[model samples]
Target: MRFQLGWSLVWATLILAGCASSRPAATTSGRSAVDYNSYNEDLSSTRPVYNAPLTNVTPVTRSAAPSATAPAPTATRKNEIRKPNPPIEALHVNRELDLILDTIAIKNRTVRYAPGFRIQVYVGNQRQDADAVKLLIYQNFPELSPYLSYNQPTYRLKVGDFMRRIDAERYYASIRRLISSAQLQADKVDIRRSLLIK
Candidate 1:
């Protein structure tokens, strides 16, 4: 019974110590007890006061009257053109960007092919039939230029280089009226030729 009582007291003391604040005990002089507000005031008073450093520059004392030798300040008119402080040539940067732009411009000037739509007017083994359809396309729509390709037994007759399906469809609708077998086929088209027709 004595051993159990001693262990219980030790556990209670350990719990009380753990629950106590970690702050140093406040010094009290000529006072019975310190209030919470007064303890906070005392802590604030112990802190160092903050003071910002001043600039070391001295003030320039200019005379009220202008000197006779000093040049008069010139004011620009509203319409007058002023020379740039730093010229436009100085602002140029990114040498790699210039090279990339030059390469793009060169590529643009040359013929470039893109995946686009075309109207297929005829596909047959006979060359004469393809020629007849090509003539008929020219007679009906003078703006469209037909392309005739022959591969062994098959000959494909396609017309108009279109970048969009909608653009091809517009001509397809008109061509289908004349040729019942006309279709919109996806093909690699010349960007320059398509843009010219557009």
Candidate 2:
């Protein structure tokens, strides 16, 4: 074991010495291996020298000044007149179009209702009861304009034109204090009136 250890140390020392000797020795000039001075010398040799004579240059001649009696040049413009565009005939709409427009106008004038939900604040056969409920809603919650509409034997006082049941449900929760029996019902809702209420 002692013999083997001594042989290993000798092998390691030999390997290290071989590696050190294989590398190139550094120069004493203290310059890098790139030799920047050679590159600078090459650049100086290729550079152009500017010691040529100015024999090719021509002398500039000055012109005489214009006399005060001579008139200055004036720019003249050609006369150009643009012609007017020809008149086009007015559009002739069909009578059927007027009928269609009249129909649309009549539809706009008529109460256009959408399939929506409303909170029924009161539903009774008595007109006075419906009016009272309407007045109660108007006085207490003016923002929610209660609509009073009669259908045959009964008059319903519905509050708010909710496009969705969720909206009616929300409004019902708020007005539940005033009208505990208020319930969401599908009704013909006026979109314009609903927007105005908001």
In model 1, pairs of residues that clash are none
lDDT for every model? 0.79, 0.72
Q: What's the lDDT for residue 42 in model 2?
A: 50
TM-score of 2: 0.41
RMSD of each: 17.9, 22.5
For residues 70-177, write the lDDT of model 2, one tens digit per residue.
543222223322222223322234556788999999987776688888889888899988888888888876877678888899898888877777777877887888
Segments in model 2 whose C-alpha atoms lie over 4 Å from true places: 1-111
lDDT of 1 at 184: 89
Evaluate model 1: give its lDDT.
Answer: 0.79
Candidate 1 lands at a TM-score of 0.53
